[model samples]
Every structure is written in C-alpha cells, then in structure tokens.
Target: MRTGGKRTASVFLLLTVLLLLLFYCNLALGTRFFSPAKLFSLLSQGRGNDPAVSILFKIRLPRALMALFLGGALAVSGFLLQTYFANPIAGPFVLGVSSGARLAVALCMMLFMAQNRALSSFALVFAAFLGSLVSLGILLAVSQRVRQMAGLLVAGIMIGYICSAATDFLLSFAADSEIVSLHSWSQGSFSGMSLAQVRTAAVLIGISAFALLFLAKPLAAVQLGESYAESLGVNVRRMRSALIILASLLAATVTAFAGPVSFVGVASPFLIQSLLKSNKPLLVLPASFLGGAVFCLASDLIARTAFQPTELALSTVTSFFGAPIVLWLLVKRRGK
Candidate 1:
C-alpha cells in the first residue's frame, strides 16, 4: 500500500510539473514572440510601445487564463456529472446545459444586433446562465421521480436535442450578420477576452469549484447508490441538488465566457480516472481540474502557433484531440 501511494504521489507530481510547463509555454508563445524573461519584465514593469508585450499581456494573458479556468471548470463539472450519474460518459454538454446556454445567447445576440444595440458581455453570459438553469431545472424535476438513471439520462438527451433544434431554427431565420456573430460564438474562441471577462470567469469558476470540494465525500458515497449513501448519513437529495447546481454553474459560466468549449469536460475526468486507476472523487476532481487546465493551455498554444500567422478555432483544436480520446475510452470500457 505504501508503494502504491508513493507511485501515485510521484505521478501526480509529474503531472503538476507538466501543467506548470504548459502554462508557461502559453504565456511565452503567441503570434508575436515574447521570451520568458522579457514577458516577465513587461508584466512586472510596463510595455510602452512593444507590441509583443501588449499582445502577451493584454490579449494572450487574459485568453490563456480564461482558457485555464474555463477548462478546469468544465472538467470538474464533468467529474461531478459522471459521479452523480455513475456513467463514465456523462458530461456537462451531454445534459444539454451548454446547448441551452447557446440557445439563450443566440436569442440575445439576434435581438441586440437587429436593434443596433450593444449587448454587454455580462448580459450575454447571464442569458446563458438562465438558459442552463432552465434545462437544469427540467433535469432535476425528471430525476426526482424517475428513479432509473437510464431514464434520467434519456431525458437530459431529449432536452439537449430540443435546445439544439431551437438554436438551429433561430440561426435559420436570423439576419445574416446576427447569424455570423452567433456562429462565431458557438464555434468557441479564446481570442478577444478582456481582463474583466477573465476576472468574471475566475470568480464564478472559483466559487463553484470550492463548493464542489465540499461535496467530494458525499459524491463518492453517492456512487454506491442513494439509499446506500443515506445509510452512511449522506443526504442523497440535498447532495444531488448541490452537485447538480455546482455542475450547472460551472458549465454555464464556461459556456458564457468561452462559448461552449467542446469535450474537455468529457475527456478530463476519464483521463484522470485512467491514470489513477480508481473512481475516488476526492482524487478525481482535482486531477481532472489540473488535467483540464493543462489540456486547454497546450491546445491553445497549438491553436495560436501551429499555423503561426493565422489562429485556429479553439473548438476545432480541442475536437481534434478530444474526440479520439472519448472514442478510445468508450472502446476500452466496452472491452472491459
């Protein structure tokens, strides 16, 4: 047991080091070059006329931070959902929460763009939150009486399909310009994130992540079944409600800020579980967060620098990496 614990600790340490290295690489590389020392100097002092510093500090920095927090939030949210549902494939997007947010944002953008009124980023984010909450409410209602996890999962999928259909209808009927804006938002980009946007994402994700930490034990207990958890003094109903809310909040916040980034939530927890060889939420949640941040940061680096002059869509980049991982997980589990 001691040897196993030591090996786990060693692996975690290695992952931590790798994550830090990726984060530094995110800060160091961009469209314009900025060495580590120079970037540090500019951040500590001020960039007067150096466009590299401006790009690094103003553009790349915030975007990278946003990606980190948003990715971590999504992964942790996925972890909670998988734990709650006892399904390895469960994730935030699977529940239609992200689609709900996308639907709301599409409407908000269509309304404002049509009227030539400026829509605050915060307002768009709030609309997404509202949409996610509505979907979450429906899921909670169904889950309360459904009893069967498979039935609840089916209901979530139906809700997602409904939201997707609505979003498509809106796009089909909207003006060309509004459609363009909505399309870009849905495709998901980390570009153009201001510091204020980063701060908002940080606060929301931080709060939700902290709340989830408190539920780690209960969530683990939940895996044995609700009645089993209740026998151990866990309040199954309250625990589920809190977990759902936290997962929704994390998913909504990330979707609102980063435009429904694909697959990190689904990928990260599964990856961590594979690495750890255990289903313990206590270990899984934090590892998922770190793994998510590392994945996003590394992907963002490739998206920005892979083509050098032109930037790639963040979602496309993630999908390139995430889809295969998801498929492999499914296949591997099927084999087991």
Candidate 2:
C-alpha cells in the first residue's frame, strides 16, 4: 500500500481504538463506577429486575450510544458545511444552523407543552430541519452580498445571536414546567436518551451519513470548484443542493436530540483533516465521523464526571476545548 493510504489506515485504526475506549469510559465512570468484568457480565446476563442492568442498558448505554451517533452526525454535518462553503471554519453552529434548529425545536416544545401534548420525535426532527434550512437560506443570501469569508462568518454569528435572542424571548413566556425542559435542552445535553430516541437518531443519522459517503467522490470534485466539477460532468447544482439538504438534516437531527451541541461540528472536521493531512472527502468523511464520535464521547465523559453529580452542559465542555482550537485556526490562517 502507498504511504498515504497506510497513514490513513493507521489513523482510522487509532480513532477506532479511541472511540471504543471513550465509549467504555462513558459507560463505566459515571456517578457509580462499574468494572469492566462486571459491565460485561451485566451486559451478557438478563435484566430480571437488576438496577445495575437497568442503569447500564437504560441510562449509561443509551447515553453513550447517543453521543457516538449524534456526535458523528454533527461532525459530518460540519464537514459538509465546510466543504460547501470552502471555509474550514464554517460549521452548523457557526453558520447559525444549530441555533435555527434550536429555535424551531424550542418552539415545537413550547407549543406541545402549552397543549399538554407530547412532541413526537419525527415532529422534533422536522422542526429542526426546517429551522436549519431557514438559517442556511439566510446565510446563503448574506454570502452573496458579503464576498469575504470573514464577513460571512461574522454574519453567521450575528444570525446565531438573533436566533438565540428570539429563543430567549420565547422562553420568557414559558411556564415554569416548560422552562425546566426547555432550559436543559437549550443549553445542550446528551442526557435522558432512551433506546427509542437513540433508534430515531441512529436511523436518521445513519441514512444521512451513508448518503454523504456515497457522494464523497463527487463532493471531492465539487470542493475543487464548481466549474471544474461541472466540466467533469458532475451536476454541481444538484450536488450542492444535496450537500445542503443532507448537511441540514444531520445538523437538525443532532439539535433535535442533543439541543445543539457546539464546536464538534467545527472542531472535529478540522482535527481530522489536520491529522489525516489530506482534504479528500473520501478520506475525511469517515475519519471525521469517527473523530467526532471520539471527541464527543470524551467531552461527555468529562462533563458528567468532572463535577461529580453536578454535570455540566455538553456544549460548555465542547466550547471550552473547541473554542481554543478555532482561535488557533484563525490565527494560523491569518499568518498564512
């Protein structure tokens, strides 16, 4: 095998190892620690009214799996946005997509709570997807006027602020009961994940991720430039649309489930590309998915365990680490 292929293979192997290790840690090191052998025995045995089994299957296991799937979805979404915008820093969060999704989900939740009705998972995802498209549309319009990538980024940030403010305004009118749920979701979290929710997220994310993988070759060509891709018989417009829809869908699913996790979208792809030393979509796509899983698993672990019974919001931990990496990227880009 070629040296580059070998390196990519090695990186994937390392990321897989890290992903497994973090997944294990997430399951093992919660408020109650479980040993590896005990965890295995519990997993292999019947539940039969065992609290530990319940904790493992119902609580810790679902949470860990949610992080794995949704984190990967968020990262892949970010990579798609970055590729589409031809900007390394462009992401669902930075581009206001997550905020848009958050706003929509918040509205959906508020409406349902006002009616004393439950919001279905499908409805939640649809609201978020619609919100993401709205945000993406606004950014696309702004991008036309603001030619500079920096200006577009600032505009995206401003859009995010506007959505967040609107969400806050909505929150002010929410009943106390509503606020408890909305407040937790608005802050971003991976808690309270059920097997059902995990199944929904897994199905949505898995399909979207597979679609993106299928388009990896064409997306690579698109990244080279639209005209170039078109010259190669790729329908650049259709490809771009697919990119937008798929990216939005992935971002929306994450927001619907996890309340708009920050930084994983931007940081994971950048880290993967840097580590892989290549920007080819075929290589970066899968690696970024795995990298994102590892990133969120590790972050989720820290968020819950760092305070010991006082869990921090997932976004807080992500931003703490991700923000520095973004700043460093900006500085490095400026130097270049």
Q: Against the true structure, whose TM-score is highest?
A: 2
lDDT of 2 by residue, 231-257 (tens): 999999899999999999999999999
Best by lDDT: 2
In model 1, the clashing pairs are none
Q: For model 1, how does the per-residue alpha-carbon lDDT over 1-74 read when each residue is reduced to its tens digit? A: 88867766875897799788887788887655668788778888765787776777788789888878888888
Task: Evaluate residue 93 in candidate 1 and report its C-alpha lDDT on the 0 to 100 scale.
Answer: 75
TM-score of each: 0.90, 0.98
Q: Rate the local accuracy (lDDT) of all candidates.
A: 0.82, 0.93
